[model samples]
Target: MASRTTQILEAAARLVARRGVRGLRVEELATEAGVSTGLIYYHFKDRTGILRHTLEFINDRAERYTTSHMADAAPLAPRAELEEVLLLELQDAPEVRENSAAWGELRASAVFDEVLREDLARATLVWAQEVAALLGRVTPMAPAPALAAAGERLTALLEGLSMRWLSGGLELGHARDLLLGAIDAELARLQGK
Candidate 1:
């Protein structure tokens, strides 16, 4: 069975994604999870604690998914490898999309919450580092700084695309195609240099 803390976090994430973090209520989360309000407090000290853990949970899953998806592409050319990574990042797995919604809520909350702001910064750094590692494997011509910058750019692009798709600005299929095409073009340009 999932631990109580895990259950609470998962429920809270779903609620936050659906209702926004500010709109989340402990009572609602507890009821959704089939637990009591005190159980939420037992696992998390308060609302902030729940939100922080929820963000961490989502980020952890994303990191794992990205890392695992890229694991087998190590031997491919840099451009191909980067394209594959971008494709994986752009493809919206249902769980990932839901988690991303939660992430968006957390990002908005970060504007007012110091803890969430710090968490967002940390998550961004982690994503940048992951992107840099993938880029380094493919783009041998660039210095580390340039490669890291490219990684940050790609990360930002994907994040923006995700937000747009989640908010119904673009269809999922179109967003994926656009992001993949952009990534492919960028990689080709990098490789041609």
Candidate 2:
């Protein structure tokens, strides 16, 4: 059986995705988690506490999701490996889309929330570092500084494309293509092509 804390966090993620972060209520969360409100408060001090764990929970899930995709691409070429990561990151299936959208909403909400802002900044850097390490594998010609910049750029591109794709401004394929294309182009440029 899932722990009560895990159950609460899972329900909180669904609630946050369905109804933005600020819309969650202790009563509703308790009902969804099938636990008493007091139990939730016991596990998490308050609403923000729940939200904090929920954010970490969602991020951890996403990283695991991305890692699953990365695992199979180990034997592929560097570019193909990078594409694997980007494709998973840009996946458009309902579950991935909803998770991405929820995270995006939280990112936006962080603008007005200091603690959340700090958490998001840290979470985002973890992702950026992951991409940078991926880029490091592919961009042999680029210096460390250049690779770092490229990684930051790639992360920005992913974020921009993801937000647009989530908003219906772009299709998932388009987002994936754009990201993969940028990766290829960056590698070529770094190779002095």
Candidate 3:
């Protein structure tokens, strides 16, 4: 069984995804998790606490999943590692989709909520750094600045495409294709091809 903390975090993700951050209520979250409101408070402190923790939890989960997957596919080329990290969130699994949805919500809400901006920015940069590191591995000869720029571009495109996909504004196949194309183009540019 999932630990109570994990259960609460999962419920928080679901609630955040279904209702925007502003709409998430403690009572609703408790009911969703089959836990008391006090448990939620004990674990997270408050709504802002819940939002912060959920954001971290979802991002951590994604990172862990990508790491495990890459480990399983050991001996993969740098390009393959980069591709997996970028595309893993697009998987059709229920958990991936839910996490993506909640992530999108938290990201969108951060613009208006000061409490979430710092954590959101931190998470965003962490993802970009992961992409940057992978890009550096793939293009060992490329200058650091160039690799960083490419990583930023790719990460930005992935996040934008994901948000659009979640909103039904873009098809899954198209989003995946666009991301892949962007990755290819960026790498080609970095490689001076």
lDDT of each: 0.76, 0.79, 0.82
TM-score on alpha carbons, each prediction: 0.83, 0.83, 0.83
Summarize candidate 2's per-residue lDDT along 1-193 as a digit string, tens digits: 9988899999999888777787889899999888999998789888888888898788778666655665564688877676777676688577777787778877787788776766677667777777777887887667877777777888888888989987789988778879878988778777683
Q: Cα deviation of 120 in candidate 3 (Å)? A: 2.0
Taking the tens digit of each residue's C-alpha lDDT, what string does model 1 give over 92-189? Answer: 67666776787777667778877666657877887778878877767767578877777788888887888898898988789878877766666676
RMSD of each: 2.5, 2.5, 2.6
**Model 1: worst 10 consecutive residues (lDDT sum):** 82-91
Q: Report the error of model 2 at residue 8, Å.
A: 0.6
- Candidate 2's C-alpha runs over 4 A off are 36-38, 63-73
Give the per-residue Cα lDDT of candidate 2 at 157: 88
What RMSD value applies to candidate 2? Answer: 2.5
Clash count in backbone of candidate 1:
1
Stretch of 10 with least lDDT, candidate 3: 62-71
Q: Please count the clashing residue pairs in each candidate, in the order shown.
A: 1, 0, 0
Residue-wise C-alpha lDDT for candidate 3, range 1-193, written one tens digit per residue? 9999999988888888777677889999999999999988888777878878887776677556545654565687889878978898777778778878887887777777787677667667767777888999998899988988888899888879989998889999889999999999999998993
Q: What is the lDDT of residue 28 in candidate 2?
A: 95
TM-score of 1: 0.83
